[model samples]
Target: MSKQPASYRPRHAVILAHPNPASFNGLVADAYCDAVRACGHEAIVRDLYALGFDPLLREHERPGTEGFRLSPDVDAELDILRGSDVFILVYPIWFGMPPAMMKGYVDRVLGAGVTSAQVQHRTAETVLRGKRLVGITSSGASKAWLNEQDQMDSLRQLFGRYLLHAFGMKAYEDLHFGETIEGLDQDYVDANLAQVGDRARAICAAIASDRAQGQAVPPAA
Candidate 1:
């Protein structure tokens, strides 16, 4: 039997939504996995829908106490996530929010002693710090239209303020490709693809830069 490579280790966890293989979201997810790997960062891609992830916050688990336990499969996912240094989300915005399954994953996985935990009894500070995040999304509407609505900014707030900030993720980035559904022009699609690739490069550069500078980034909104 061949031995495993000692040089291989994953550095990033990419959680993807949208079930259709033919969908643009799927293509973007694939691109991200490739990009991350090319930069020498191991990438763990979680196809939330394909995994049949249960998104419902069980009635008993609503308070997020020890109300629910992960099934064998979910437990496995949580374990993988726990080891990741960079957490990336690649999904399409439906009505300006995360897909149901992705949202549910957060509800189930992020809580006390997991994504975050309280510190000292006096200040109740958080210690689950030191992580990075990036959001990659596709939209059917034009960029101008999305700009008018401030869709991307609004989403940044949702992730930065609610999830990353709360969980102690230090840095955050977002990339969007709008007007996908209007028409699938090869030129247009290629341009967006290039943009995504650029973002991936930026992500790699930022990681190295931040580390080199000894900078701790605050989660962005």
Candidate 2:
């Protein structure tokens, strides 16, 4: 267990994109939070739908545009985000992609306060730099079919590679739970959730290892 001294434990921001609180995506987020908490860490679960987070990107807010600044809402979110180490996004996929809300979060939050030139030149000081990203996506379709269409590949390129590179994140992974329907199979759901917990544990372990290594290494003179 993490013993969780104030500001001492690793913080995980679990971004949940499901409108339905009872959704599989929600469950996945829950399992992740539970597992991390069990490990003595903190979990900040943000349900975008419930929070009524605006996903709209204003034209004036674009980095290159004049009078560019983070919105009050975005600032609030960032206040909640600052000091967080890991980010986990849980959403349901439609048409082989995340919904507008999910994309909006990335555009408005993850992609905020940075210039296009910075991204292209890798000059932006990304707040997410050296952090970890875990994406959990649920779909009604089969993984094989999605792969045949190269949808997952495209998503990986967009999320796994581009997003990580743009944000300077140390690592990224997306776990897809497919064939998820209204009436889910209990056994299958349990198994998938177990996997989610396992992943959470692994992340906690990795975070601990990273902290240990950082402490062990001496700063240069």
Candidate 3:
């Protein structure tokens, strides 16, 4: 039998979209997963599209009644996700947001008993406390255009604050690449992936080092 760590073992869950292997977003997601593992963390990858996870939030799935029961696949997803100290979202921005598949994963997995709940008239406090989160995204717009449009920057306000902070994520990071529209050169895609992959590794390394030293990993500057 293999030996295990004495007490601590860093665990991470990475969710990805874009099932197309030729897609730049998919390549970046794979690279990030590899980087996380290199940092000695147990990285779990969730490929939303390939998994065929239903994104629709029907009334039957709502919290309450027998309809709230999760399907076997969803239950498996929850199990993998709940074991992590860090959660990573890797996808491409389509029309200024994540794909439908990823959105659905959030709807089902991040629901009641996972993130937060309600108590009568007021909302209750969030769970998923002490967990960290990060995102890696690629978009078609040029960097200048996106900055001018405030797409990536505005996203932080949504996922970082409203979504993640509301659910008690202790840390969050985003790695975004742009100018990936039609006719984009393959060289650019490879270069961007290399840069983002290194960045991911650095971030995870910093976290591991901080934990090893018994200090909190400082947030991105």
Candidate 4:
């Protein structure tokens, strides 16, 4: 497999949001991280469920309050986010959206005074500009059903357009693996896992190409 140049290798923060260790989402996350490391980048995998991340935004954790203060856990996660050049999110679609823990991570860790700055008479200034985000989601429903119900579009809007753009980060692909695990053969599962590895390599290559050309990485379509 081709590797990214040492100078262009980027730091990656991989967030896994599934509760079950034996789930397909966990397999994908492991494959992604392995590919990232194989491509010569540093990959840190955070299993939110395993970490026992609090999915609630308490009043004290609310932004703009005198009592607003991040817990030690949030602080540590924020540090990982800040130190990484790329973010990879692997989760299962729960009610057509990311799980509560992932949403809570956004609310608390990426809240005001951390990943963004408020400016008078304008939108919040995104402090995470120049970073990249990629999301990999799995669903029990068929892709056709998701498309018919517009859940795919909703996912794109929520993660790619709204969330990443809000943070001024480049949205670099969102892969949805639908019809997950139920009645699927091992061959089919292996194929999807291979694709995950391929995507990881592609991400590294894109970043390296951008650096080589001295250009900002373009958002993935």
lDDT of each: 0.69, 0.87, 0.71, 0.79
Error of 2 at 13 (Å): 0.3
Q: What is the lDDT of residue 198 in candidate 2?
A: 94
Error of 3 at 43 (Å): 1.7
Local accuracy of candidate 2 as per-residue lDDT tens digits, 1-221: 13434359899999999889999999999999999999999999989999999999997668878888889898888889888899998998888788899999998988887888777876667557778998889899988888999998899898778878887888898789889999998999999999999999999999998787766646677
Please report the TM-score between candidate 3 and the true structure.
0.81
How far is 134's C-alpha from truth in model 2 (Å)?
0.9
What candidate 4 gets wrong by more than 4 Å, as runs, is 1-8, 112-127, 215-221
Residue pairs in collision within model 3: none
Candidate 1, pairs of clashing residues: none
Full candidate order by lDDT, most accurate first? 2, 4, 3, 1
TM-score of 4: 0.85
Output the worst ten-in-a-row residue range by lDDT, candidate 4: 114-123
Clashes of each: 0, 1, 0, 0
The prediction achieving the highest lDDT against the true structure is: 2
TM-scores vs. true structure, each candidate: 0.78, 0.93, 0.81, 0.85
Report the C-alpha lDDT of model 4 over 107-176, residue by residue, as the tens digit: 7765534423442322444335567888899999988999999999988997766766566676567888
Off by over 4 Å in 2: 1-7, 217-221
Off by over 4 Å in 3: 1-7, 64-67, 114-127, 213-221
Better of 1 and 3 by lDDT: 3
* RMSD each, Å: 7.2, 3.3, 5.8, 5.7
